[model samples]
Target: MSDKKIEAEVRQFTVSADDDGIRLDRWFKRNLPDASFNLVSRWARTGQLRVNGKRATPGDRVETGQIVRVPPAETPPPTAAAKPKVERPTLTEDEIAFVNEIVIHRDPAAIVVNKPPGLATQGGTKTHTHLDGLLDGLADDAGNRPKLVHRLDKDTSGVLLLARSARAASFFSKSFSGRTARKVYWALVIGVPDIKDGYIDLPIAKQPGTGGEKMHVDEEEGLAARTRYRIVERAGNSTAWVELQPLTGRTHQLRVHMAAIGHPIVGDGKYGGQDAFLTGSISRKLHLHARRLRIDHPDGGQIDVTAELPDHFAESMAYLGFDPADGDLPLDEIKFSETAEGKRRAAEAAAKSRRKERKGERRSRGNGSEGGRSNSGGGRSKR
Candidate 1:
């Protein structure tokens, strides 16, 4: 490593409301553009970086009015090698037309595409022709290709958002990771759930021996996962069209959760086994569709866009005697505090409070202390 001298004075910044809820590394990229991510991470790892006088990590969220302390900025030598630029791949005419055909909405900062089923978002082993490979078709005159902010499953059809620039990508990425962006999905399940509308607070983990290609519910060593599902219309007791909202983002979360409840999503044979397929004229394609996306725009206001269902999903719905119009339900903003897990937490807290009260009473009786002053200055906190 080359010896580099750092400046003596430390830099301090107060978090702004606009930058609130963003990651610490992103904060540096926005305000201190000169500081590279490597430098910020190094500062954090070595305990040179702090937030509100506490050591912080790059993933830490910053709140408004919080003080962020940074070590002295490092200046690289003038003779340092310049970083190589990523070459943008040239796209064929057909590739550009294909990507453009899927574009349902486009703005200065974002591009919303109705990605069809069977198309992988990004390429992997044995996967070449994917959405990411063709993203060069969406590049602008400056050769800046739109960046994918979120991804959908290969067999899932829906609205996929893309950022037009690096700055927009950072902003949109923060919006998604912070869980401020809302996604509404429509799916057809094998059977109707007993509860018309309820939250599925089941933890999920990757299944063993699947090479991380599959997920399953693992209560012991799984990540907290929650999904809110509501039955839209039932075709007798056989099948039901449902609206799904994932409270937490996990790989194949909706598919895994539905299958765990004995009502697997239509055509998801990987998780649902043989029962995932339906009889009669119903199509065997995956019925899950990302119907709508509502997110805060970096340019201000909100970008609320809906995607039209694919031909297979639409055809399946028609064959199932369900109206396509019924799938266009309003997407409401939901809070975790209103979920079943939230209620359970509240009950536990109340029980703990009662237990503490009883313990205090017993102690007071044993000590014979009378006329104890009660503290009644409790104040509610606002999120």
Candidate 2:
């Protein structure tokens, strides 16, 4: 390697067609492999790095011909600035086989899998193996890892969607964010709901003391959450199979809503307490399952799919004499009244989405597939 010192000056570069919509940090990793995340973050915070004369965040997407200015990087001592490179973990043979067995449908644009219960979506603290790690099974021909369009809880097993390419990912994510996608989840609650077919309109907030991924009904200082549930069948008064459709995608929304209605999903001890348990040889695993997903396909059509129940859930249903055949009922769309705040939010979102749509149309006309974009606006949001 040459021992020349880096010049203490600013440098600007234009984004190429292939690199459109990629994160600034990712662009740096590809263009300047030696730049560390810490260095990029520090440079962004100090305004030493910018895009088209504007301050650039590491998460910001650089468009074609956008001028990205980078300050001269200081070369610290090799031993002091040695940053470890993160290598993506590969799936084991068993994991790959498991993925193959669970995959219900796949195409060039998307892969729909019947994710089993007890598997986390993304990796986190005290966790290593996850659905994200095992997604190599659905990688594209170019070895691009599929993108997660939505999330399901670790304890709830059901249909999970993944996009095969960046363009498809953008389209699906925008569809989900824009409320064009519909979801149907099935669960066995402890008690039969008195109001068999009604909506559970309640606000949900992060419980202050749960110390983990737990939520509570807090109409005062919480986000608006709503779910419509219909009782499909009941086994005595102890358990009932209910079909649910969530209007807003909040963390732990379904679990919290059912519990709020005094018929917590069976085996959801995190919120249901003692009532979550049942006697006899019935399984204690969470009974929630994502039964169906309906979304607009990237290829200009609708993709509606259903997932079969997991083994434990199937066995439990058999033990309770709850037939699965009768659970298939056409899903109904639910509507809500627009409050003052809701109207304001709706108007703002509509305007922003329209601008993005126009920008996408212009880009498509100029660059075709290379500039294809969705309402997600070239990149995913922070949260």
Candidate 3:
């Protein structure tokens, strides 16, 4: 047989600091935007793509400074370049107008937008219009589409960052992964916090039965979660304006933590039930707003931005005796991270609680022998 023909040229790329903690598939999407989602997945499963020379799965997380090898995407043969490049999909007129309206700041590396509430960052079921879908409108003449480096809840409005290129995306992703991105959020709570400035250390986990979007505090069966909050203003005893800085990124951490402390975030019906609504002048819209964001830029500078409150949030603030100009609160002083050991200890405590519950169940059972066996200490009867 003749010598085997050559395959696609394999290329190696070193993951930058900003690209940390991203899934392999996401990495491909950021770096090779032209490649189909299925194509990158196929390369991973077939061993054409790899991490550090070893075969890896698509869902595998790639850390900062790691090397990822990608096989050449299927392209036309050598003479293909002679043909003109095909046109890219254009954004709808509405999307173009929307992108233009939300853009607060833009540069070579990133575009910062004041994302409005009720707009989902990424698309989902029944979500036809989303920020990410419309980001294509911001693409340059070269067809380099902007990418979302982070996300915000659908009902939470404020400063949202988008990376204009793969390099910038990596930079911002690393900033979030390394905990260097300082985020401050403002919320009008149902009740006043007794302590003006304090920390809420609670373990949060997914609720037992429901969609994965739900998060609840479970001492034993949860991940470590912590939030630092300061009372910005008090609207008498009924409600208060609070500024919160989350130390850990857990699903619904803020909503659950505030609820656990007996002061649920105003308008958060999912956690506070009927109590979420404040009847009178206060609107029933969730009062959470991502007020400000500060992070390092990819090109060796810093980006600090503040977003104006949404209409509902501003109205609630005014109604609740909060001044929109009270921006002097300290935001970035706290340095906190929940260690792996702490989370492990919390999980152990939950496991211990489960074991004790099982023992109690055994004791409560009608079977005397099972109850005795579970509750009994030493085998022999003590004198």
Candidate 4:
């Protein structure tokens, strides 16, 4: 067979002394903006990358002031790309105020915001206002709309991370999927657990239901989940301050595991408990909060971010006699405009009215009219 040969364009660069023993992939990524680690390693494996004109491996140590040559492979032609048309939603006066208040830590890589309860991370069919929808308005710089790398339950408020770019999103997503990203949560449960500082190794499975899919702990046919918890304080006979670290990223893993151990979250309605609803014991809102996260930086470093507890969570802490500022918890300012507060109050009033209506029906039935509206008085039983 005739030998097919293609000439390679060799590019050379001298390594600085400071980068004496850095990984070859890292060094190439720093120098070549378009080349990724996979490309570098592939070229190295094919003897296309050399040190001092000798074939080199991707893991070879580079001494200071050594010349490295990378042979250029056949580069693919750039494909036609379209600029994404981003639709920025208009925020209400209250939403603008809320967005201005909740941002705790922000950088070019990621943004950590204090997500208030009742705000969904993404939008649904009936959801008009959501965190992702409002991100373009909350960005620090123009044309840098942030996007969520992960999610939090609508009722479970606290720290939420948003990636600034698609690159950052991919990097952070990998970090979370690999379990290298550290996530910590603060919660107030119904009762104190038996173990103060230990792990709950359980499995969670999606419960078979019609309305909304909820999670339940099923040891037999469920995915393995783990949560490490520690008791921060004991609050009366019914509530306890707790910190949780989820080892696996399952849907509702923490909520299901805590409820499975006889101590449900203060305001989780899906699980079986009296205090599940917001109108129950916890009056304010759900007690779960994502407090902190630690992640690797895309620029060869690590970043530690913390989001403060919301006002309602702080109120719960006060009710439990604990200081919110006792530790390094970041405090964020939240200002609910009068218009927003009015809407919220109206919603609550409507919910209360509906509950009263249901209660009235139950009481009316107690007055001895339960037998299908009494056929003696009805001409033809409306059916």
Candidate 5:
């Protein structure tokens, strides 16, 4: 309260270690509680706000020892309404217990959960009940709720990771974007793939009419998406249990790729349609599950964890005479760049580079020839 002054005066603050990887707006909330977000936006827009002498935005992360330049604060006009703070929804006893039961692994930096099928990760229109809304139950003693770093489809069950703090969230987000995190998923496709172990190199784009909720293979206009799958066991041509590792993260990449190859995941009506179902007691739940995750931790070592299958998936495996013990197959000990698709991409890029080099060489030779002719003719090209 004492820092608030009517006279125009600029202020600068050094980012502390605890505020290392948080957003610029978040820093304002923590240090200068009186500074409203509207004021911050105005400062950022006019180039009055800066981070280490460069113009900065609210979303930019601040590191330790960085200088954050702030504009002068002024008393708000009488008409300006105070910004309202959003609070977390209260959870009932059962809801609190349900979230606590899903936690599989907990550390200082991360929390892993065994999310069940039919439970969405975040809420959306017409989706009032989701894991994100119940996160208040998972708050630590200090009331810091973990943040979701990645997402799983509403019907996909398995290991989902959460960051305990903003620093960990930043670190994990980078790991995922950089492709250093490894995720293993298990699914039962209707039919077996002929090539037991291979890559699905397909480009995907949002489908035309589904309002961006659906994805399809679009060779010309799609983003590059790849998945590596290996058939673990076959059930007499009825269904096959496969391990899928996505090399690129795309919306519905696994489901789309599997259906594209004539084998759709069991119970996936969105992509597989009516043929995705099976006769008998098999449950009509999506057969895909995120089996395992391995990623570097923010503090020191790595976090490797595997989730247990839900009741339906487990029963289905037993009915097909497949042992659950064989589900956790060792991840391929080969680098992604060593795959067949990787080699093809590398070759294509190299060829393009060679073409450019050849064109440059030809241009250089033409210029040299012209220069020689001009010199011999006792003339020179003007600069």
Candidate 6:
């Protein structure tokens, strides 16, 4: 390892207010502009960042009035010892076959693949095969390594975007951040929404008083979030096919919002009903897919890409008595409530607990544990 050191100062600010309560590493990237998000994540894992002088976890919230202490980075010294070479694994024939079958649309700026359910978009620790790993062999253009610009859940199949070059990747990233890219998702949801078509306008805030692993609707403290949905087909009395467009990007925003309104998407384990994983039901694979994407092409034209429905989605469509080739469906306007009661309850409970703890500490200090006290019943013993 190479030796390097970095010193940082403590700051008084809240991560929740700044990021609408995003993950700690994401918040660090926004605040410490010079620090790489990956490096910040490393620091978090190694206990280099602290909250109120105690080591902090990456998921811990930096609330208002709290002081955050960012410690200096400690880098190990390099040695002259020879390093062992590690071999890269070759792709299996089965993996190659899967990649060869998924290409639906391709262009100079972007490539859209019909991702099958259970295939990961990118690799991580313990991931042996992923879309990126298979790309070098599948690309039609020689010497080009396709890069994924956005991600789909591992279990949710459909359209996945890949940028052919760094320039294209940057352009698409900006478009997504600016809310100019149009992403349409297809899902089979439990029960039809009360309204035919509408926008969900709820503001999304991270769950307060806990680590920032969950999000909830909070009108006062949450960031503005919007999603529009329209019913595509009614699959009997219990389920309906719908199209979704998110106006704001929040992690798992669509799933959470849908569940909040009593219409969770089928097969969604995190937010769906109890029987979500059972076979022979609509709740087996989350039934959600990134079906279409429309964006201003990096090469100066509009590009619209689509992915064909996977086998499961097709089976559900046929079961619902809807033709898979239908071009248009009625659009509905669904709106979400600006405020959610759950978030308010959490915030209030947090405030109350903080006040109680402060009071208890004050009493403890007054009761004398300061320097030294005579525990043995002596007449005013001094240390």
Instruction: Answer with 4 or 6, whichever has the higher lDDT.
Output: 4
| Backbone clashes in model 6 | 12
- lDDT of the candidates, in the order given: 0.82, 0.80, 0.77, 0.70, 0.84, 0.67
Model 4 misplaced regions, further than 4 Å: 1-88, 91-97, 140-142, 275-284, 325-383
TM-score leaderboard ranking: 5, 3, 2, 1, 6, 4
Q: Mind giving the per-residue lDDT tens digits that candidate 5 earns over 191-306? A: 88999998999988789998878989999987667889999999998899999998777778899999999999999999999999999988899999999999999898899999
lDDT, residue 46, model 4: 87
State the lDDT of candidate 4 residue by residue for 235-347, as single tens digits.
66668888887766777888998888888887776774666533333454678999888888887787787778877778778867877555343322222222222334468
lDDT, candidate 6, 49-146, per-residue tens:
77767777777755422445665553335765634644346777887687777888778877778898888776766776678789865655476667
Best by TM-score: 5
**Full-model lDDT, candidate 2:** 0.80
Total backbone collisions for each predicted model:
0, 0, 3, 0, 0, 12
The true-versus-predicted C-alpha distance at residue 188 of model 6, in Å, is 0.9
Cα deviation in Å at residue 78, candidate 6? 9.1
**How do all models score by TM-score?**
0.70, 0.71, 0.71, 0.60, 0.76, 0.63
With a 3 Å backbone cut-off (N, CA, C), the pairs that clash in candidate 3 are 18-170, 18-174, 220-350
Task: List, residue by residue over 1-383, the lDDT tens digit for candidate 1.
Answer: 00123558886666643454568887787667567788888988899999989999999977644678888766668899866655546778998999999999999999999999999987777987899889888888897778776789999998999999767876776666556677889999998999998889898877999987898999997766789898999999999999998766777999999999999999999999999999988888899999989989999999999899999888888888899787777667566466433454678799999999999999888666443322222222221
Name the candidate, 1 or 6, with the larger TM-score value.
1
Badly placed stretches (over 4 Å) of model 3 are 1-90, 335-383
What is the C-alpha local distance difference test score of candidate 5? Answer: 0.84
Best candidate (score: lDDT): 5
Candidate 4 vs 6: which has more TM-score: 6
